[model samples]
Target: MSGARGAWWARIPEPVLDAVVVVVAVVDVLINLDDTSGPAWAMATLACAALIVRRRFPLPVFLLTLPASLMLDIVFAPFAALFTLSERSRDRRLLVTCALLFAVASATPWPLDDLSSHERAWTLVYFFYTLATAAAPVLLGQLVQARRDLARRLVEIEEAREHERLLHSQAVLARERAQLAREMHDVVSHQVSLIAVQAGALQVAAKDPDFREGARTIRSLSVDTLDELRHMVTLLRASGGRSTELTPQPTLADLHKLVTTSGIDAELTGELPPDVSSTAQRTIYRTVQEALTNVRKHAPGATATAHLWHDGDAFGVTVTNTPPARPSLPLPGSRQGLIGLKERAELLDGTFASGPTGDGGYEVRLRIPNRAG
Candidate 1:
């Protein structure tokens, strides 16, 4: 539609359009008049002036030149309909317009004085040559625009693909965070419940010094465990407990109380890595603690061993115990302690496996990578 409007203005026949196209062409030749003169100069002016209507009524302007040029003969200009076919449009319009332009060009200079009678007999030959030459520049411009449009579309497709990838990544992160929160809730609640049960038992059995000492140990473990649980909650709320009230995090050194409170014979075989920060140590401690709790509940008579080793890149831990002599006792309720331990190991870029070991024993192994907290 815009192309049609521009073409209509070009062929408006207003004094301004006529004067600009005609005067410009004449001035162009006058500036280089020494190089060419006569028929060529007048024809150049007519071609320039006729082009004002080339985009709007291309076929009509080309036809108009035929009668007007026949009257003036040597002074007529060649018609160029090249501009009409340059824009993106239907093929039918281009074919009709080009045919009309060729007809006008063929009839205008009939019976050329410079050619032999045999050559002049076929005027259509010269008409086709002129049509091809005039259309060359417009065809080149259209090809360039087509290539540019294809490049723009390719860039748009790449950007849309990148946006979808980012959306998928955000959704996965949200799901993992929710799963981690659920695991933490189960682990902390299980530990607190066990501490409460032990405290109640000690209250009735305190006549013995061993029972009195066990009661004190339970008090200490409960306090320390609550502090770690609070720290975990703070981490869930934000990045860490920076702005919240939090007790100091536990390390491998704190595993002593954890084993003591459980009232089990736990033989420690290897040393823990001293170089790693508090977080990794705490994670290892919690994993061992959870594995021991499982042993106590499911295999009460089994003797347990806690092993910790450092092999340069990671801290390796193993908690293993023998089978129970009697039927396994059921705790108050089943809890997700092992699931939380796995989550804690993964958060630190670690690997974990827990199940029955060969030789009728159960074992849990964790390998936590040594990275800066």
Candidate 2:
């Protein structure tokens, strides 16, 4: 509650605060106005009024208040001015000098009459007392200044920490993108290479003219796809340092194009609900892609079907391929594609399974909760 009141007080206008200070100083002077001469009253009034501009000209206001301190018993005007000066000034020597001047002014006798030895000694003692009293405002002002400095420094430190967190997050994202590029080059490039080889062989062996033409088209598409993949890999690898255009991310809507250009006899069936998130759509698309690529690589001359289905609380895709009619190629395999797909499924709180079916065919399945959206 005190903190809230302090904040409310801080919101008060500066001019109004200065006016309040002046009024308080005048009241203090009036309270101590017993037996004061005309000149003393005039100086006290001057001191109180000078406080109106003490924030802008603290040293001048403090000097104006010294005469009043010397002639009258009032303290509020001079101490207020001294505190203002101390808070704003960084020069320690100047603050010490002003403090000493205030002590001398307030302790010395107003009239320039000769003082007796005892009176002079007592005046010296009073000077020390006044000097000690002056230190309170100066020290309080310095304390407030230090508190403000510490608050500002803490704000700057927090901003630096926030910026560091942002950089760290970006670095982590860049590393993930680089890793993704490596996976695409390793897995997708290998599948497209197999498609090119198969098309070339089919083109040479086929007797029908239309078969030869289709093989040529397939081979041409495979080469073009390899080129695009190479470009995409280059962009993804360089994304850490500079901006680069990336290929559009695949979604359910692009499943038809993916199945058509997959360089295999694959059929896509069924549809997911329209409310699925982009992340889920991309995950589903990648699942089918990897499943189809595996069938072309490991099950030659086989027909594959991708079925998308959703139950009350879950959705998924299953890709099933018949047994190969021809012997599989002796293609190298690292099995990283399936591992990546499994990891992707787990990240979305889903499951992935792939194994040979009872009919000597292979089936890959992915199932995710609807909340994965």
Candidate 3:
């Protein structure tokens, strides 16, 4: 019922509530004027006016109402001011000071009365009653303030979560845009490169001056198109503001040199056929490079073992690295290399597998069928 009353009061607009305070104070003064003298009546009237601005200046208004309450039979003016001051006060000094003053005023007898020394027990009971009355309203005010603060905090948290969700959505859209640009580049670049090669063949085979000149023009146009396509791809990649290494593509023959120069302790077992196609060689080369790179990145200063063999109709390659012993500058990667490698192997109707070993190391395996030219 207290909660329901508080909620109902909370819905009351501030200006209307302030007006209600003035009306109530005026009524109190009118009803209790007969019990007080002329000076007390005048003070109570002024306090009733002060109640109009009690919320804006609670402490000052409470001071006005305190005197009026002491000298007159008006109860609501002082109690209302007490509740407002306690509810709105941010300073500890104000709350404590106002509380003590109200307790003292409530405990004291305003009208002179003859009482004997035997009424000491009655004094104690009156003191306890006054103290409890002073405390109860202040506690209620504190509870109301706490509820308001909690509501504000909940609203702020919800707004923050909504902002985070918006940012995540933007990030997802950007990644999809980059992926689409990449697909366009790969497909377009490969076809243009083939056209350039065919044009070069035409230039070499033509005999007539006119035909040779036409072939030369076609070759030049195709080469220029391929270059433009490469530039577009570079721009797309750089749009994300991520750093990229500007190095030449690695191949199978560069494996030995890579392992040696990178200062990585690795053992290569079995051998690759010397007469393999460039496509096959490039796939094998990049797979080895990516595997070794992961080893150096995740487990620096650890020993890695690689095994490559031609098994009947398919070629199998496996690379495994142990955990690092001595920690070094850890490298960062998105593990996108493994994802690309899986796609690469699948395109060639091959198999790719990678995971942790039994000894807490990492392993990657690839099996390529020999059926492709």
Highest TM-score, which number? 2
lDDT of 1 at 110: 32
Q: Which residue segments of model 1 deviate by more than 4 Å?
A: 1-85, 88-96, 99-103, 110-120, 185-189, 192-373
Residue lDDT tens for model 1, 1-373: 2343356554576667556655654554455445444565555566556767665765555554444344333222332333344443336466546545545555456333586676666656655655565555356535544544444434444544575477466555545654565577678757786886788678567898888888878877787777787677556644222221121366778777777766566777788656777778878878887888677666656789988887777776899999874344233545588888889888888998988978888999999876733
What's model 2's lDDT at 172?
A: 77
Give per-model TM-scores: 0.35, 0.60, 0.54
Q: Assess each prediction's global lDDT (C-alpha) against the native.
A: 0.62, 0.85, 0.73
> Which candidate model has the greater TM-score, 1 or 3?
3
Error of 2 at 334 (Å): 43
Q: How far off is residue 315 in model 3, in Å?
A: 58
Q: lDDT of candidate 1 vs native? A: 0.62
Per-residue lDDT over 1-373 for candidate 3, one digit per residue giving the tens place of the 0 to 100 score: 2354468777799889988888888897788676568778777878888878888988899898777766776667877887888778756677767777766665556665766575656755776777677777677777766665555445444554675587567656556656756886778888887888888898899999899899889889989988887887776665432222221344566667766654478988887666656666666767877888777656655898878788668886789889865333433558799999998888888889999999978999988888852
Q: How well is each residue in 230-338 modelled by candidate 2, as lDDT tens digits?
A: 9999887887432321225568999998898776799999989999888788888888988887877677668999999999989989999999754453557799999
Model 3 ranges with Cα > 4 A deviation: 1-13, 112-115, 118-120, 177-191, 203-235, 243-373
Off by over 4 Å in 2: 1-6, 209-214, 241-373
lDDT of 3 at 239: 49
